[model samples]
Target: MTVAKTINRKLVKTITQRSLSTIAPQVRIYEVGPRDGLQNESKFVPTDIKIELINKIAAAGIKDIESASFVSPKWVKQMSDGVDVMKNLPRAPGVNYPVLVPNLKGYDTARQCNVEEVAIFPAGSEGFSQKNLNCSVEEGLKRFKLVADQAVKDGLRVRGYVSCVVGCPYDGPIHPKGIAKITEQLFEMGCYEVSLGDTIGVGTAGSVQRLMREVLTVAKPEQLALHFHDTYGQALSNLLAGLEYGIKTVDSSISGLGGCPYARGASGNLATEDLVYFLYGLGVNTHIDLVKLMEAGRYISNYLGKPTESKVNRALGDRFKNHNDIAKMASCDV
Candidate 1:
């Protein structure tokens, strides 16, 4: 099936009209910094700093934020205090704060916290499915159904995620049909939207476009989001391919902080700063202050004691220091 066949008539018209106009506006950036960005940290980030980081991120005008996860503490240490994070953070007015919920128990926890939006994920590759969740695809979907059903009953919006959609660490390559099947199941299970993730970051633009060709058959672009990892330096390229297919929503992390545990050499998700820069360059409004975003990334990276993985952040830092040094030299001459 073609791209045109997958998107709804209204969505296609909207995308085409937007793409044609030079003054075409904003791109929605789903901030996955708190959840996806911190998941791979070797050290525990203090809860205080985590709250502070989230506050700063919201202050920077990020409208959609993935705040935390409701998974078992034993499995994801970074989100052990998921409930506390939900309770303490200064909620951004009009912002949508979604949390990751693994199963029915997670949904119950999120409901107790009064969170209305939650996300559940399944692996696109069979090997990854076993390694990540210790089950077959059929069993995982059964588990996801429990969460998705409860979420809807509780008046919560559920977002579905299919990880390793393009390539898998254990499985060498993925067939697009597999992506279509998982995505269709998620949508059928009451997920309002599904995000396709290139978890191992091995996708190219051409391959991604082709894979999307199959996925869009069963899911509308409006009901889908793209999550690309920069492991092979192809995240942006793959993102462009999605854009061409009229995918509007994207998940990105601030400063590109996390990496895949299953794929040793894989890089983090695409950085929020770079996404904003690229969107702005394309005359797309993200409503994000790029300079403020850089500051937010730098603040967290300092606490983490690591150089930021974002190339845009690194260059911007160098430019600022260079200008400051130049100013000092001019002052000395005076």
Candidate 2:
């Protein structure tokens, strides 16, 4: 056989071998665009705009959407209108809106807005915790514990976020054991689910696999979710590793907006459009309409006067343009 034919045969054999192991049948996309995706904007988005964005995202069939953050406006001015956004949100049955609560004060603010669920973040790297939260890792966890306890007492479901799971801007690479410890603490503190964030977006498939192996020891795959940034272009690859490890939930932003304020060079969260496209190819049901989701992305991107950061969305748009051109040519011929 020719070299090209031999190479093609080897590639086919590799794919067939890999396909023998079935991927998960269903994936829960946790949309954080309105909250995490917009928090980093230089100019504050209007409350009306934020509300409309949330409504559009919900209409796109994303059940779990992080709507806003209850943190101090002094720290994140973009989210100053969190209360108004929550109060004015068009409530839809079966859609659960969760807000980020930084401390007990934030939790109180979220409760006043009648938030059904709240998420608290703790940094896996000590340096990042100190830099981001202005406190040591131990102190940050203590604060999170207080908030988590009170949130549970108030009958609210709590979600935990551990940032810089793979590497940190300040501290460099993070050991998997450190991530496991924090994840275990969050679960023990009554968090229903813990999301592991590659805050700086520096994780590769090998690093992600190593981290997952350690984290899965203390927490089950069912209790965990993966949150990755696309800074290094490894977000999708890292997500594939997570899926292979039985993680069914993922956190993504719409149109790939927003990045970590503390991590200077970090990019936005993994784009929801891109994640959905990847999942669909694997036969994983996300229960979200791609067209509707793209519309939402386009609306928000246009409102912000920025091009979409989602590769899948851009490619789809290009494909549509080509099809339209072909149709126009056919019409002229007729």
Candidate 3:
């Protein structure tokens, strides 16, 4: 159970670097396209297409994929067949496919699918709780505790999610104290890692820095991940801040095709293509193929009939065209 001290030391060192040098050399991207991205879709995506997207994400060399969530159909109709989606998806080698489970009922359904890893979400804001889960923050955590305990006994790896850590539509300016307390509860409940989410996409770098400063006091930076929405177009900026603080794990979507239903007009999670481009440009190692990843993003965006939210995808599209044109001219030279 011991991680080599050398590895841990190097990781900690990478996290301490300044924003200009903050790329973690080796970043872990948790792809949430199938679950977090699709959960907000008004149109129901076919199960077959969902499986295909998981395969495409895996093919793009993303090591962690949030495959689906086990929630009620009434709430998230697109993810109603989470168990079936898991059973049918192409299981790529060396990829961790984690599903989101809200409570013991969701966990029970996920376990029936033989899921080895699952994530539970507890809101950090009370107003968001009343609107989203129809319960108090404490009640949500109590339910999460039951699910977390049972999942551990069932030999499942649990990752926790804390939503609205920065701003809430119903309540503004959440304190770091509340975020830290909730995160501590998640970790205490046996979560292997806790992903702090800016569900409404209202966080700036300054806010994210403060939030991380508090959360890290209780949770190790290595055990934390950032899940940001780009509503204010500050996701990359905040991500930069996370890197500076030694947080190497991030959750993002391809083509940026999601938003929280509870918080309208939010730009959803940061785009995977954009995050990959940002890291790769800095010579940081993410191991994702930007060109292929863009293709994946483009494929999904095309299917959705929407222009991509990724700056990198649009730029790459232009570059791809130029590359093809140059190849044609070179053939003429021959």
Candidate 4:
């Protein structure tokens, strides 16, 4: 037992060191604020506010933003105005706005809006696939494949999302091989990238490392992205684990504004402000302005009537207040 423990520790250390050694100089922050973030809001977010949010995110230097989803209004009321959100947002040059398309119907709507990219959501766990998507995993993938094929034929870029990659609320821990098989299928179906999502935020660094090791065998690290929720306060650490594996793209929401309506007890996503702050500290270039990003977070959080979930935002606000108070004291003495 002692020898086995020592070998395991050495293995983990070796993996960590190797991952850190090849960290990319820059990472792509795939902002999902306008789509995934707002989709779970109970109150209907006004179309204008959603548009303003996307514009602000773009202004803050997010190159890739998920503007909206073309899902049914009856199912996802918050995204009922997906078309309007895409049409009204002032399109910035060199910025790519992708939208979610659940099937051919949603894909057709997005294509009519001249969407450059579209994403399909498929779950890694059979239980989640049945519960959330209302279909078996195989059936869900079959549906996504049709959409992916059509999108690629229409000259649109396709991205794939595999939810519950780490563990599922309905089904316990997911097998890493399950995630790898699904990721491989998505890549085979012409998806430019596939994001592995810890939908319920039940993942830790060790789990993420183990999952990535398997998925990386089927898909290149560059073709994968990590989407983690902060329910367990381990999102950032899991993200760092992914980075060590050379995964360059990350999915995050501003103000941490997302939850799975179908997954009971699930929390919001990893806040964009927090992700940017961590990346900046690592000397990794995201080309995102932290102050501007927080401003956007504040804008959305105020609209939602909730305090920003980003710890970095709160800390920065306190720092600014302290500076202001010190300046006021000096002025009074003068």
True-structure lDDT of candidate 2: 0.89
Candidate 3 TM-score, true structure as reference: 0.89
Worst 10 residues of 1 by lDDT: 321-330
What would you estimate as the lDDT of candidate 1? 0.84
Candidate order by decreasing lDDT:
4, 2, 3, 1
**Candidate numbers, best TM-score first, in rank order:** 2, 4, 3, 1
The estimated TM-scores of all candidates read 0.88, 0.91, 0.89, 0.90
Model 2, 1-334: lDDT tens per residue?
Answer: 9999999999998986575354568989999999999999997789998988888888878999999998888989999999999999988999999999999999988899989999999999999998889999999999999999998898899999999999999999999999999999999899999999998899999999999999999988889999999999999999998888888899999999979888888899999988887776665777787777888899899999989999878977634433233333323533
- Point to the candidate with the largest TM-score: 2
Assess each prediction's global lDDT (C-alpha) against the native.
0.84, 0.89, 0.85, 0.89
lDDT of 4 by residue, 72-123 (tens): 9988999999888888888999999999999999998998788999999999
Candidate 3: the clashing residue pairs are 15-246
Note each model's CA RMSD in angstroms: 8.5, 4.8, 8.4, 6.6
Report the C-alpha displacement of residue 212, candidate 4, in angstroms: 0.7
- Give candidate 3 misplaced runs (Cα > 4 Å): 1-23, 321-334
